[model samples]
Target: MSTVISHRLSLLEDTNDQLKQQLESLFEIGERNEQRFVWLKELVLELLITENTNQLDRTLYSKLSELENIDDVLLFIFVTKPKVKLKHIRDTSLSEVPSRLVSLSKTICEVCRANEYRSIFNVSIDSSGSFALIPYQFKDIQGVLAIGSSEPARFAGRVDTLFLDFLGEVVARVVSRIS
Candidate 1:
């Protein structure tokens, strides 16, 4: 009886050890996935900034869609300051986007008050509302690129803003270079 009990204990220990090894493998895979995602994000940023000129719009859109898996990318530039009107609205396909465009004071629209402003991936100005004052700085002269979707809550307020801020900086730099 004693020998049998010892064998059972050894078998249990072996199973637990195997599980631990499997967990370690899973953890390593997760880390690698994370690294791949970061690299892909960096690549997208590089493409956004580096690709300039009217001819390269399609190429940039293709590269961005492939890398980020986003539906579309629109680059709107506000040439005028204060109440920055969109000087240019360039889409991935170069088709005219008829949606209403505005830049908010902050991420949130004044009338809508929806925190759905995803500064990184989606920066939309309310079409219905008039050109309201942007509470943020305009001296930077960067137009906000709003990601449009039929789905409203996709870019809801809960998302983190760090990645978006990085993208915003890239836009600012790109605009500076173009002008």
Candidate 2:
């Protein structure tokens, strides 16, 4: 019957539409991934060529400052042996951190609510803000790199942080070399 054939055609058309939408979304994700790769490559190159810890700090800050969603970037490094003393190191000591919070060996990228993580951040951020904390280690050097966003939902939950993890690794290697 023509009615049956029309119903079948409608079903097929709906499926086709869904597939098209999925493909378009995939393309968009691909474009975003490509951009991340390009920027990450450039940042790694700059960090590698940086001469000293001061220059390294500037380079790292500049690279992270360029991110659109992030309002703040904080780097906490406890230099055991001073290759050159860092000027802006926060006054907080390792004793300030709770033992349960920093199991550094297995620490990974985390998205946290600013209000709940208030104890960790020295600088003030909106209680409604959010943060992406990426942990890194290089031999004896271990530190956390935090990026804050004014928008509460910007870093909510365990969203995709693949690029951030890669960035942390690259930073660890660069820190080992320079600091």
Candidate 3:
């Protein structure tokens, strides 16, 4: 009886160990997926900044679809002081654009629930979050890129702004060429 009990204990221990190993493997996979997404985003931004084409909108839309796997994206260019509108581009319905822009504040806007666009755009991400890239020099309002994912946590409020800012700079150059 003693021997049998010992054997059972050993088997239980082995099962626990296996379960732990499996959990660790799953965590590693999640980390790798996140890394891949970030890397792809970086690569696409680099390409956008370097590309010398008047078709900035087309190129950007294509890259956004391929890289980040976002559900929706909207690009708007407006002047700050006089609030003049230069251009607007959307991946979806035109009627939805205004409600989306309404959430944006006078300054750089971040993700928030009040933003109706954020809710709709977030449907595609495995992690859910919305972000906007607004240039520091708001005089001309150079450009703005709004991205949202279905994944609730993908574009957390804490994400670094460097990438989006870089994107804004690139868009500014593209606008310069076209304007």
- Across 103-176, the per-residue lDDT of candidate 2 in tens digits comes to 55533434555554565554466566777777778797677776677667777775677777787787778777
Clashing pairs in 1: 105-134, 105-135, 120-164, 123-146
Question: Which of candidates 2 and 3 is the stronger one according to lDDT?
Answer: 2
Candidate whose lDDT is highest: 2
Best by TM-score: 2
lDDT of 1 by residue, 50-80 (tens): 6454523554455445633244355665544
Off by over 4 Å in 3: 1-54, 79-111, 118-129, 136-141
Which lDDT values do the candidates have, in the order given? Answer: 0.47, 0.68, 0.54
Structural similarity to truth (TM-score) of each candidate: 0.47, 0.81, 0.48
Clash count of each predicted structure? 4, 0, 10
lDDT at 81 for candidate 1?
33
Prediction 2 TM-score vs. true: 0.81
lDDT of 3 at 17: 100
In model 2, which runs have C-alpha deviations exceeding 4 angstroms?
81-93, 96-101, 104-118
| Alpha carbon lDDT at 21, candidate 1 | 100
Better of 1 and 3 by lDDT: 3
* RMSD in order of candidates: 8.9, 3.0, 7.8
Show the lowest summed lDDT stretch of 10 residues, model 3: 79-88
